[model samples]
Target: MADNKTVRFGLLGCIRFASKFVRTVTQSSNSVIVAISDPSLETAKTFAAANDLSPENVAVYGSYEELLNDANVDAVYLTMPVTQRGKWAVMTAEMKKHVLIEKPPALDATELDKIVEACERNGVQFMDGTIWLHHQRTVKIKETLFDSGLLGDVRHMYTTMTTPVPEQVLERLTKEAMGLAGAIGELGWYPIGAALWAMSYQMPISVRAMPSSVSTNSVGTILSCSASLQFGSTTTAIVHCSFLSQLSTDLAISGSKGSVQMNDYVIPYKEDTAWFEYTSGAKFVDMHTGWNVMPERVTFDCGGTEESQEAMMLREFTRLVEGIKRGDLEADHRWPEISRKTQLVVDALKKSVDIGCEVVHL
Candidate 1:
């Protein structure tokens, strides 16, 4: 068992994002980095050195298996490329170590299922590193908007995340067939996740690819795409993701009596303060002039000694791991359930695009 106050984490792979977690795990109150590993010994050594991780405290391993075998590690933070994450995640879970994986957890729902099953069978916690969901701002929204019924009945949601990538990078992604490297898998995950959250994690009944908006490369890799998710007869969500657009991470939700709009939902524009606009009880003037209420900016402060979303995520996962270790609680199933729901939608959207933009009923 790990320390009662802190969970020891092993870095499973030295991907680019691993650097952030190196700092985050150190900063978190309930977690500490105990090991680091990569396929190349030199790379692992270099990453540890670059991140200022001390060899005296943090063991460096030339191979992932060695890190997994480390008896001191109670959990693992897997930062491998998305395509390789599932297999390693399963391996980590099989070793009875809690696993916190990066976003887009698997190539598809099928693979994600295997990873989650492994975690469940081994009684290890499983969580995806989706930063925004861990933010206090998100919690505030859930309380004030949805839980309080300030937004009323959710009628529709619109989310988009797009950014322009270089031509060569897009070409390389297409050639290599990186799992979900296409706009849909890479960027669409954000919008789809937002939509599901707005809907209280309800599965959409159907998904339809907007063929008119779909863009593909020479090798038929999706460079950009738009899809519609039908939640019910009266509710729908429109999502657009792209690799060839101005940077945007917009989330808008309309309800019977109010609406919420977020321009930087994925990554807050500022680290210290994140804001969203909310308009409630809106109505037109007698003369059909400008409406009565305008969007009110709701700001969430994340400053002071408060942890970043990344660190909070680690702390939360570690708390769960600790509870399980003490036998006071079972591993939290909610995180893996959320990831599975997100992956299912991603699979449906990809299927719709592949089958000539047909409507896929879930």
Candidate 2:
């Protein structure tokens, strides 16, 4: 619960995602996007105007430092690139403001540790913007599968996420922006978080990655990854991620009695679809017999004029801001822990790629 009084927010960058976050805050009850800073003044003004925000209500700056120095801001959201996230987290923590950074908080555990320590020392709440952790469907899925144990003893879990790369952004996507680790950073972390939350924080015993390049410069167009995670009592799970082809996402869990499949697991913007199949000796039966067994397709009906990714991210940013102001950060566990474990797997995957797809220990 956020305080009735609004928490003022200053966005560090008016990047594509930041704009969406601003709109989300505007629609929220307990927060306001009071200011924003980017390296481009014209771009900032245009964004403000497009969002129905008065120019006076928004502050445009040519640098991020100015936004950090603003006294009206109670919190800051950093949607910057993964390579630059740690620096901004440290700086924001030092400013005495609550911080919610975009996923893959840092490239590795050591960098994430430094950012976490800085926030702790500064007495500020820190969160990674892994919104699925806050989603109602995810909560229900975990409850039905793990808490109720209705699916029988858990046996295996696997996930895959992939998307086609646009020609204009191919170079940045391959080498600089997120790199292979960073691409997996966003899409991979969600399922990892889901596994950690449902499995009670069990760490994977070993990881192996098979990376293939469709082009030169080691910018592998596709990464076929397999990580074997050993939970207690012989329960094992394998996680997979790739950027090899068209946009497709799926997660399947196998159990003794039945299996549950969550299709389109990573992106909520896509239809939220799932199905359950019960094993009957040699074959399986759809539990919802004769009916559409798929989980109800959920359309992302966001209440905003803008239809960009930034708009979607900003709406959640507002909720997080309100949550911090009211000290309601306990709604989700496994944020910090999942973030750490996700990075560990990603680092291991990178090493596996470097060493010719060898199996690496967790």
TM agreement with the true structure for every prediction = 0.96, 0.80
lDDT (10s digit) by residue, model 2, range 56-166: 776666677888998777788888777788888899989988777888888778888888878778767677877655554555666765666665777777766666656
Local accuracy of candidate 1 as per-residue lDDT tens digits, 154-254: 99899999999888877666524556437777789899999999999999999999989888887877889999999989999999999989999999999
lDDT of 2 at 315: 46
User: Any idea how many clashes model 2 has?
Assistant: 6
Residue pairs in collision within model 2: 17-310, 20-310, 20-311, 21-310, 21-314, 24-315
- Candidate 1 deviant stretches above 4 angstroms: 175-177
lDDT of each: 0.88, 0.64
lDDT value, residue 183 of candidate 2 = 52
Stretches of candidate 2 off by over 4 Å are 1-4, 179-182, 211-233, 269-334
State the weakest 10-residue window (summed lDDT) of model 2: 273-282
Candidate 2 whole-model C-alpha lDDT, 0 to 1: 0.64
